[model samples]
Target: MLNQLIHCSLNSGSPVTLTATEGLSSIAQHEDALLRHLFQGYQKWVRPVLNSSDTIKVYFGLKISQLVDV
Candidate 1:
């Protein structure tokens, strides 16, 4: 599921990218192992998107902070 979401986020249109980011935010909030897995995926797939979009980069940063706070 995470792989599929990451694939969709990487390959799909902007709206799907946004939705996938939002879903990733939710998953990060609730699941530590999944969040770690997500970060591994991030290193491969999501990092480029971060370079392209400030909004997503900031959101992803906030989600990381949320994990730290927990």
Candidate 2:
């Protein structure tokens, strides 16, 4: 799982770019499945509150994206 997650995180961004959310957008499984295979510890803390009516907001560069999985 570590290797798979590491590979995914590396591929999520380009050679020189990194995509780590430092603040609010902390909970996510991002591009290249960076957050998918990894972040289990963080996910556990956030998932219980991610109810059907809730929404996830992500910030990339200067843009904000919203994802709602019901």
Candidate 3:
């Protein structure tokens, strides 16, 4: 689905362009290259938990108080 859009954009020479110092071979290569560029330096690991070393316990709940018949 996305590949079709990339192909159309590449063929039509839209304002948006993707280039490399060397070159990309095909549409798949172009897509992979674009993804790599887009997600470069993205981390999948947690860096800090509220900037603290100790474990934090988060508490949450909902209270309901009512007497009715409906």
Candidate 4:
């Protein structure tokens, strides 16, 4: 998000024209990248756990809530 903001700010004077669809598609791509990165981080943190059943319940339940907002 900070990188994107910085890029936009630095390119503020650049003449870049994006159609509505293009803008939305770019945003969707960024969102997908961010989500994949986040999920990988979560997996790396929790995948070496002790109890599979409890981890599954906790991770999936929390993921479901986050997915709802996403």
Which tens-of-lDDT digit does each residue in 3-49 have in candidate 4? Answer: 33422221235432222233666778776765564455354555655
Cα lDDT, all candidates: 0.44, 0.45, 0.58, 0.47
Model 2 lDDT on a 0 to 1 scale: 0.45
Higher-TM-score candidate of 2 and 3: 3
Off by over 4 Å in 4: 1-22, 44-70
Number of the candidate with higher TM-score, 1 or 2: 1
Runs with alpha carbons beyond 4 Å of true place in candidate 3 = 1-16, 19-25, 47-70
lDDT of 4: 0.47
- Number of the top-ranking candidate, with lDDT as the measure: 3
* Comparing 1 and 4 on lDDT, the stronger one: 4
lDDT of 3 by residue, 1-70 (tens): 2233322243335444554333336666777877775566778665558675768677999999998999
Ten contiguous residues minimizing lDDT sum, candidate 4: 2-11
Rank order (by TM-score, best first): 3, 4, 1, 2
Global Cα RMSD, each model: 13.1, 16.1, 14.3, 11.7
lDDT of 3 at 4: 33
- Model 4 clashing residue pairs (backbone): none
lDDT of 1 at 31: 63
Q: What root-mean-square deviation over C-alphas does model 2 reach?
A: 16.1
Candidate of highest TM-score: 3
Model 2: weakest 10-residue lDDT segment is 1-10
